[model samples]
Target: MSRNLRTALIFGGFISLIGAAFYPIYFRPLTRLEEYKKEQAINRAGIVQEDVQPPGLKVWSDPFGRK
Candidate 1:
């Protein structure tokens, strides 16, 4: 192979390998954490009679209104 082609292939291969190694260790954990949070909220709602809202699901009628 030519020098430039070999260099490009090596660089591309290295980036692919790094992404493959990182996805499970980094991205998978974050995904599982989100799932766990949802499960916890479901359990909390089941245990309580009142409805439970997840962290980001709040609605406000007035944006600037005081609480």
Candidate 2:
């Protein structure tokens, strides 16, 4: 009922709410990183094509053969 008590209660409640929201959005992914990696690996295994190579820049050479 007192002003100081009310302020403390409000501050505590705000902190608790922030922590609850962050647990799922931030903490959960970090804790499950390995599990997520495994799941992604399984999902991608069937999608990869062995014959197709990923795109990248090719080697460049000068026609004059400058030293």
Candidate 3:
């Protein structure tokens, strides 16, 4: 094989190996995290929740005289 072809083949093989190694380490965790976030959003949705926060603990809605 020619030198240029050999160099290209080596680079391509290296890239494929890196990508294969990365799939489980990086991509899988990211996908799992996205799935977990989706589950959390579903679980934390207001429509499904039963308990509500009291006025004193409510955020940004000051009923008392603060101003």
Candidate 4:
């Protein structure tokens, strides 16, 4: 192979490796959280009529309502 062709293949492979390593840590959690939220919404709908909190990290309301 030509020098440029070999360099390009190496760069592409390195990028693919980085993406593969990152996929589970980044994308998988997001997908799992989405699935969990969907399930929680369904379950909450069945059990509760009012005051249903969505499934996610709980954030306390600021007492002063600044945020």
- Put down candidate 2 lDDT per residue, 19-64, tens digits, no spaces: 9999987787678877766765686675645335456744433322
Root-mean-square deviation per candidate? 10.5, 12.8, 12.5, 9.4
Measure candidate 4: CA RMSD. Answer: 9.4
lDDT per residue as tens, model 4, 22-54: 998677756677675566567656554334556
TM-score for each predicted model, relative to the true structure: 0.45, 0.52, 0.45, 0.49
lDDT scores for all predictions? 0.69, 0.71, 0.69, 0.69
Best by lDDT: 2
Q: How high is the lDDT of residue 57 in model 4? A: 46
Candidate 3 displacement at residue 12 in angstroms:
0.9
The ten-residue window of minimal lDDT in model 3 covers 57-66
Model 1, span 3-64: residue lDDT tens: 99999999999999999999986787566876755665676664533344455765423322
N/CA/C clash count, model 4? 0
